[model samples]
Target: MAGTDKQQDMLAEGPAIILVEPQLGENIGMVARAMANFGLGELRLVSPRDGWPNEKARAAASRADHVIDAAVMFDDTAGAIADLNFVYATTARPRDNFKPVRGPVEAAGELRTRFAAGQKTGILFGRERWGLTNEEVALADEIVTFPVNPAFASLNIAQAVLLMSYEWMKTGDQAVRPVESRPEPAAKQHVESLVAYLDRVLDERGYFRTEAKKPKMIENLRTLVTRPGFTVEELAVLRGVLTSLEKFSPRKPRGSGAPDAG
Candidate 1:
């Protein structure tokens, strides 16, 4: 499903669960069920091999309606996590990349600290068969691995999600973290709308004429827009600017009477 509905119906202010290239709908459903079992709400899917809105996933989710209903899909790992300030990659094997490695309990503790400090956090789970690639793990700020028996390090996607979910729930509400008095960050949907609007305007002006460069340009725009915790007022102001630009004089040219060229 689209992410707009998920943004509106966000349940708990817990860390997001991002599934990258999940293979089976049943696994997706089970992951959602696990997240719901512990109060985790946001679930993001990055390029699931089997498309979304899967009946198998829904049936597997069973009574965990909230998690399944609010699940959102993305095209890539970077886009899936663009809105999150902090992310943890969950894996079983060791990689050559240089990153802070933490066990589940330690990572959970760190997540709590970050949450208390008002940061959007997420946990990245790789595919069911081979797990996360170095490139995907590199995207995360830290690597989270379980202390499993070396002989059998493979962990099911759903099982890994449940363990992290359980730890996230373990941090009791009593944790005294200062709540920010400022306005809550604008929802991802609203931010996306603003970006899309700007993109449309740019497109009409032939700003993306170079077909080969358009993707990178768009990526840069999205990154620039979503990196900040923009407030509602800020978003409104930006959209207003775009609207004004769109209506700006297209007839008059500079000193010479040359019509505005595309």
Candidate 2:
């Protein structure tokens, strides 16, 4: 049910499925099957080998006849996709000048985010045997790729589309900014407290009295502690560091020549 919201928003932009020059009726039917599984409709066929909307294709599609019924035939790939605002070219390997390669999930996430931000997008999948030509792929706004074991990463076109759809459904509209992930604020606070406790111990041991700029030194120390945005684990680490420093400090308690355990 986690992906239900996504599943329902399935067609936020009424995205179209553009199959550029499918080779077989079975593949078209399979494509239809894949689209139906993910609640995607609007099949745009750019020519075919066995003639589309046929019984063979229908048989392959099975319950996904809605896609077959409404399948729009096109004379060319551009004709099929001319109405789309954004296009994603699905490819397994890089070609035609280095472009940013997005994994299925990542591409879906981005497309969904863009759709939520009001962009009509479509995915451009090529023929199975030869994949998309450089000319066809060049028409796309971005390139989407899948991660697989390099030795055996050949994914069927329908499968590739389904995976991308699954990821897009999961993405929703959260435009998460990529940052140098920091620990939680609460954890950061705990680290700050640990550092404070350390300062108090060092001060009580007269390490600061010997130094004229004690306040400036502690202020600088505070700056370093506050910026980490620490997590619980990070705070624990700060505590460990303080404990180690305390054990190794030159000063000691009145009876043991060790820092006070206070």
Candidate 3:
């Protein structure tokens, strides 16, 4: 496993690999090792069961200290993914949901496309025992499900992460395309804010109608809003539109009197 090539620069730029509620420090360390093997550096841990700065994880990293050392921990999945522009939830079993699904190869290709466009992306790996919950899966833009044997589909957490990391690396420079300059995609937080604002307005308007259905309504609204991948400027324009609709009044007609000299 000693394949250090100091002469060549390490490939450290790629999608963030997010582990949601990982249970073991050793597993986290193995994940870091896998990430390092494929040049993925950004590691996000959402509520690691064993807590951060675990010595066991460091020991398991096998000299991949950079990935382990730079890892970030978040209180919850939403916070962990708030800064990402796009995300893919890695799950094995079907969740009986409507989210678009892609295999590892196709997912990797899409990752390359988004990365080339200057959009930050990440992939979410669920708990080791069970995969991502439906609510957590809903936060992601799409689903990434591996095409494993039906009889034995479960994959170890590190193995799941490694498959994605490896596919991302395998896609490499060949998958990247020429990208045109454009406004950066709005981060998840921006979308969340917009959704929250809309939800508040809708609640004031009694748009939910029924208390029991409110949660589903909000979830659907979030899914709808997040699917478009709005750019920063687009989001600002949307906010302006919403504000004007809520509060704008007809202004006095521009005065016919000569305007102040420039």
Candidate 4:
């Protein structure tokens, strides 16, 4: 009973953990255990790969019955997060459209602060086989990505959730607070503005005005620019790039730097 109450408190403090179409019962149960590790317990399963209420999952949950007992099953992702005021989709790859992204630590800190501020947040995790679909990603207000080794960046579902849960656990621990190790997303307005500026720079470069296969190339370029979940710092770097181009581009004729006559 005490454990159950503790789990409930954790949920009250932490954001809802949403697993999108998880593939196995064991993984589902493992996720519960991971949540428990960070004092988190509420679990929302959306279109699970293996049907829920399986003994297999129970076995994986082990002593985390409190987590399993409260696990909610949903037929759709939207249904699972319907009551959530904020949603963040976790992915290893990126979307075609520019989406706000933050490091899990930054995201977790933001969530903890927001939860205390009276807003409900949801963290969405995708399937073990495949991550969230483009359609699913569109539903989120934010995105979270880990700084994993590029050679092997594919993180499994439970592992991914664990990292997120761990981050959220450090709400007040100043020693463990976010440092240079992690970066948060740039605001929507900032990203949009930077993108517009980049388009202008690229235009000046004639990157988009070429005649051969220009249409396809521009489409691809736009997608690439829009995909990364850029943080304000990243956006600043790019903006610097734009400033540099604007200063030098549209190059004057040869000997353009000649001193002006008195």
* Candidate 3: regions farther than 4 A off: 1-12, 94-97, 173-175, 181-183, 247-262
Of the two candidates 2 and 3, the one with more favorable lDDT, higher being better, is 3
Of 3 and 4, the candidate ahead on TM-score is: 3
What TM-scores do the predictions have?
0.65, 0.60, 0.85, 0.65
User: Every model's Cα RMSD, please?
Assistant: 9.2, 20.8, 9.3, 11.0
Sorted on TM-score, best first, the list reads 3, 4, 1, 2
What's the lDDT for residue 19 in model 1?
94
Residue-wise C-alpha lDDT for candidate 1, range 85-148, written one tens digit per residue: 6778898866655567899988987788777777788999998988887667766667899988
Model 2 ranges with Cα > 4 A deviation = 1-14, 173-262
Alpha-carbon lDDT, every model: 0.77, 0.67, 0.83, 0.73
Residue pairs whose backbone atoms clash in candidate 3: none
Winner by TM-score between candidate 3 and candidate 1: 3
The numbered model that scores best in TM-score is: 3
Error of 2 at 77 (Å): 1.3
True-structure lDDT of candidate 2: 0.67
Error of 2 at 239 (Å): 63
Instruction: List ranges where model 1 is wrong by over 4 Å.
Output: 1-10, 173-262
Number of the predicted model whose lDDT against the real structure is largest: 3
Return whichever of 2 and 3 wins on TM-score: 3
